[model samples]
Structures are given as C-alpha cells and as structure tokens.
Target: MLDGQASDLRVFALGTDRAGGMATAAQILGGAGTGPGEFQRPTALSVGRDGLVGVFESTGRVHLFGRSREGELEHRTTFQFRMDIEDGCILGHHLVVTGLHSEHSGVVHLFSTAGEWVRSFGRFYDTDNPWVSETIERSLVTCLEGSDEILVAPLFLPEARKYDVLGNLLWWTEFDGLRPIYLAETADGMVGVGTPEDGYHGTIGVTGDVDGGIAILQVGFITRERRESGSDPEISTYVLAADTGEGALLGRDFGRIRDIDGKGAVLSRGVPFPTLRVITWPPSVRQP
Candidate 1:
C-alpha cells in the first residue's frame, strides 16, 4: 500500500502470513521532503524490469527505486513529466503515462528514464473545445503482458485502444453498453469527475491489464428503480479481451483491481482505511 503522509511519504510491501491473514508492511521507498528520495502526493506505482519500482505523483513527479548491493531498496533517480498523469507503467528505461497531453493532442505520453521527453501518441478524438477533449480523454494506461504494446481506456467512455510503443494504434473497440463515469461530491454538488457530468453517475474504473486483457471494476444500476432510489449499484470486475473488448466476468464486489503482476492481481478494498489483497488469475469462476 501507499503511505500518503506528508511527513512520511513512502510505499510499503505487504507480506501476508501462510493462512492469508493480516498483512505486515515493509518500507520500500521514499521519505519526507522535496529531495530526490522523498515523495509528494504519490498516486501510482509501477514495477519495471530488473526489479525497479516507480512511484508517480499526479503532479508529474516520478521516483524510481531499485535494489542496492546490500539488497535494500534504494532510490535510483527522479524525473519530471509534463502532463496531468493519471496512470503509468515503466518499460525498460522509459515510462509511459496516461492522462492529458503535455503539449499535444494525445493521451499517451512517453518519457525516458533520464528525463528526456519521448514521443506522445494515441489521440482519441478531435474537437475545437479543449475542455471537451480533455474530459473525454481522461484515461488510464497499462502495458500488455509479454509485449511492448500498451492499452489505454478513457474513464468515461466505453472504448479502449491498443498501441505499440512507437505510437502506432493497433486496434480500438467499444464495449457495448459500458459508458462508465466516476461520481464524487464536490463543492458544486455531485459531479461525474471522470466525464464532468453534473450529477451522480455510474462508475467504471480500469485497473490495468491482466492475462493479456484489460481488467476493469465497474458499478452500475441493474434497474431504474435502484438508480432512482439511490440504492447501491452492482459492483463487478471483468477481464475484457484486448482486441475485441469481449471477455468473462471475474467476480462482483471483490474490490478494485489495482495492478496485475506475476504474483497476481493486486486489489484494494474498504474505505477510509483500505486493505490490499492479491488474487490469482483465471480465478476458477467466470460469470456469464
């Protein structure tokens, strides 16, 4: 889990007992300050090749940690991105982030480990209004397993796009009936922050890729009555195939899948204080 404390910013590795009970935290990276090893408002985590871990902040700061000769996690470097990053993944010596374009008309932006700006691509739509394009392109990006390809999905749209590292769009498909919006209560009242709608809306959040597909957690009303009454919507997780946007349901109300690695799918559940768990893939049951 991430420690967002202003005085003690860091990431911890949770180790579970044999019985899969409570977890113990081990400090992996970070401290407290604007210095190289410290963090500020860290938002996302990415595991790269060679046991390197990346800690990202929404403000475009990134801190990379790697093991030292003494077998301890040491802060290797820090870099700055030029976008309002939402999610990202580290590929070899570069990092790929998703959100708004730093200075162009794309959603996916790439940067080198040494802070060099790489090419940005994956333009979703075109419009003269910057607000419309930015709201519609609020996206999350993840790298496909065993390949250099990446998949990007907008938080409010039912569409997903796959692209190669060279900024080539391979395929794009829309998930039928799956327009998900993120709702939050702001000073202006309830708002769909994901798409900027003016009221309470359904939610569909993409966690990342698992088993060569996109894993998403979504909440939706099954009936108009439930929606009208403000009843809790059904929560479900699904692994949709990368190319076709078709796949099987993994489970319902099982927590938000955060990132999938070789160990499994990392999930965060509960509120106020969250608990993290890892569930194996091909999870033994597939809902129709």
Candidate 2:
C-alpha cells in the first residue's frame, strides 16, 4: 500500500491491477473518502491530508489537485510552477537538480504547500552545452516528507541535500558520483538509489556527454566514506537519508552516481523491490 495526495486528510492511494490498469483505492483513515482523478505518466506523486501534489510532463506544471464534487478529482491551480529549464526532480515538496553537476546554469525550483517561492539554489542561466542553450532537459525526481520539507538529490551527484518547500537549504553532504542511473525512496523512508553497473566509488564521474557506468545503493549520510557488505555486484545501490546523509556503509565497491534513471525501477523493472509495487506517496494523505 503506497500513499496518495488528494486534499488534506489522510494518505490517498492510486492502485493498479495485475492487468496493468490504474484505479484509485481506499484506506480506512481519519481523512477524506476518495481520491483525485486519473493521472498520466506520473513521476513524482505524494499524498497530503489536504491535497495532492505531483509532476506530469504532459501537463508541464506541478499540479495541486483535490476533490471537487461527488468523489471527483478537480484541478486546483494553486501553483503552476515549471522547472524543465534545467531538467530535475519536482515532487510534493522537494526539487532535485543536477545544475551543480552539469554547471550549465540550470534551475531546481521548489514551492511551499501554500504556494510560495522559498529558496533558489542552482546555477545561473548560462551556455554549457554547445548543442543546447540554457535548458536542463534531464530532471531526475523529487522526494518530499510533507509540504515544506523536500530532499533535492540529483541523479548522479555524490552529495544529497535537503531543503524546505520554500527552498531553504537544510543540510548537505559528500558522496561519490553515479551517473546513468535512477533513485527511489522506500515505503519505510529509506532511499533506494541504484544504477546498472557498480561504480559510485569516486572512481568515475558522470557528465552529460559521457556514457559512464552506473550503480545503486541503500545507504545514509556519514562522517566519512564507508563501504557496505554482502551487496550484489550486479547493481550498486545506496540507502541515504533525506538530506542529512546519516547512514551506514553499504556496498561491495564504489562507483560514480548519475542523474539518468537507467533501465531500472525508475525506468522499467519487472517488479518493485522490498515492497509491493508502490508508485509513490500522495501529498493528500499527509494533508489535514
């Protein structure tokens, strides 16, 4: 059971059957009775007790939806923020960008639940790529705890930082770079960072033009670099905390972290690891 964000009550859920059909389900909670309307190719989705917040490239705007009438999801234009200028993650409360990694003047904008611009921490607009002008077309994903709290971790950066929904910098730490991979948070709050190859050991660096190897891990922040034991060599993964970078030594080896969510869960895998294929937590579930 995953979380859904509809409109400030309890956790909402959007489920799919074995036949690959999508539908909204129910959870007996001290909140609302229904969910928002159907969504398409949703990337970052969260459930708040009061409303739903997510990113759908089709709409090209971070949506704030709620129940309109008779258990129907209505689109409420609380905020129409866009961040594709520098492709990055935009979820309920977090916005992760690789502007620092790319150094091409990108943007990773974040907004409060009440629709307020908090903090802006990205490279200024500049021409880095000869092929492209001032645009970041590779956003990873955004993770959030509530409305004002967000974890802005890029795809292949060694460090993961946290910030308030208003964009207030919370904390930052160091890590190896892992590119050409993807990142996902677990139901229990652990981030499941993974890549195709095992490399994020500070051995390789992930640039947009270079075709670097990938890895994944389930780790958290620490004082210094450490390694995990009994990890699968097929894929390197890290389980990091949401911005604090406080965790354990998780890996058999190290590799470069990346911003591209390769052919993995963030892309396409048979089934979700650890837990049943939970899409993401909806912001509405956390709302009240």
Candidate 3:
C-alpha cells in the first residue's frame, strides 16, 4: 500500500488452486508477484496508462489486458518479442515499450493507438555503438501528459538516453555516482529524475536542462525509517512537485501497516502497527 493506500497494479488468475490459466469463474490474482511468462516466465506486471494490464512474460511478450468501456477485463493484445522483455507505457493513444535482449541487443518498440506495432528507435541494438554495444539496453520509458517524447531511462547503464516520439535518441548523459530511482518528463520540456542519498534520510533528486545543462531543484530525503524503525513516533504528510524527479530526495521507505479495509482511507496510528507507508520523492525537514 502507498501512504496507506494500495497500488492498482494487480495480478489475477483463472483458477484458484494452482498456477495456470483462467478457469470458467476466473480469479484476479494480485500483489507484488510474478510467475512464468512465454519462456523466461512472468517477472513483472503494470497497469499501463491505457488501463491495459501489461504483463512481462519471459518469452518476450508485453501481454496487454484491459477492460473495455463496457467494464469487461480481458486480453487486449500481445506485443511479440524477438529477444527481450517488451516493457511498455501507454499514453492516450500512443504506447511505448522497450525490447531488451541481452547486453548487446535491445531497442525501443513503438505501437499505435489501434494496437498495431509500429517501428523501433536507435540503431537496432548494434554491438559497436560506444554508449551501447551488443549489450541491448532496455530503456525505461515515461510519457508526460503534454509532450510527445518519451523519457527513456536506461537500465543504469554507463550513459543515459532519451527518445523522441519518432524513436530518436535525444540526449545521452553520464553521471558519476548518481543512480536513478525515479524518472519522468515534466511539462517544462525537461526530464525529472530521483536518486537516493545516504544520510539522515534518503534524498530525492530533480534536474532540468537549461543552456544545455541540468538545473537542480529541491534535494530532499525520506525520513520514515527514522520513525518506523524507532520506538513509538508520530508522523507528518509530504509535499512534492506536481511532477516527480525535480530535485533529488530520498525515496520513501515504509514498514508494514495493518487495519485498513477495502476501498481505503487515511491512517495515522493503529494497534499491532505494521509498516504501511505511501512513498514519494523529497524528504521533509519539517516535523509534524
């Protein structure tokens, strides 16, 4: 649960007893879980912007499932894979996914609103590229509401890359010790990133491009560990930018939380308190 709320990402199945396809009645499995895919097995799942259930099956298919306007949930389509996990994001009409094969064979897979697979970006995962080699870099993509470009966050490779809507690499940056935890595109024509800083709290980082350089916003840290890991403690809420990855702050860490029922509501304290926190960027210096 995030901030005592549950993420919509869910997993479901058709049968109740075993790991298999759906039975007649069908069961919706959920929580942070994974199973077998086509070949490599099911590793991850997400609710794409299009509300389609995107599943990363091992055989290289970003399985798409969604409920139509009629409120029926079913398989929408399947994005095939030559040799990679086809991770994807769906904007209003555009869907962008990554096809990662190995250390030297990956590319960006683009799809249209009609569920038709389109073209790909980059040099088709060449092995000779300096920033990329045979090492196929499966880029992490984030689509901002207003922009056409997809902010591509590579898999912590030596260099970072961003791609436009037409599948062109826009920028490739290299940071010394900065490992990215959050990535998104902002309305200001810049990419937002969050990184962790080890100190009193976790740090959140954000930077925007200006004069061909990055401008840092607020740097904050997550302090939940201070309270959750300690004795009885009070808590405070958090405030972040309308978008994330503006300045670096520690990501929020939470312990278990108990006593919340279905649907949901705000919770401050509870008996037999477990860790339940909705994490975000920018730690707070102000006390509650």
TM-score of each: 0.76, 0.44, 0.46
List, residue by residue over 185-272, the lDDT tens digit for candidate 2. Answer: 4566454655444443221212110011212332322212223432322334454544354544456323323322222222122122
What is the C-alpha lDDT profile of model 3 across 1-288, one tens digit per residue?
A: 111123123333322423323223232432232332222345444444456556555465555667867666655566655555534555556666666543332466666756566676665333444333323354444444334555454443423345567776665544344333444445664545554443222222122222222222222233345445654322211222222323232333222221111222112233344322222223342111
Return the TM-score for candidate 3, rounded to 2 decimals: 0.46
Candidate with maximal lDDT: 1
Off by over 4 Å in 3: 1-40, 44-50, 68-72, 100-106, 113-115, 123-126, 129-136, 178-288
RMSD of 2: 14.1
lDDT of each: 0.66, 0.38, 0.42
The best-first sequence of candidates by lDDT reads 1, 3, 2
The digit string of per-residue lDDT tens for model 1 on 190-273 reads 334543233333444565554435545354334455556655446656676666656666778766666765446676754435
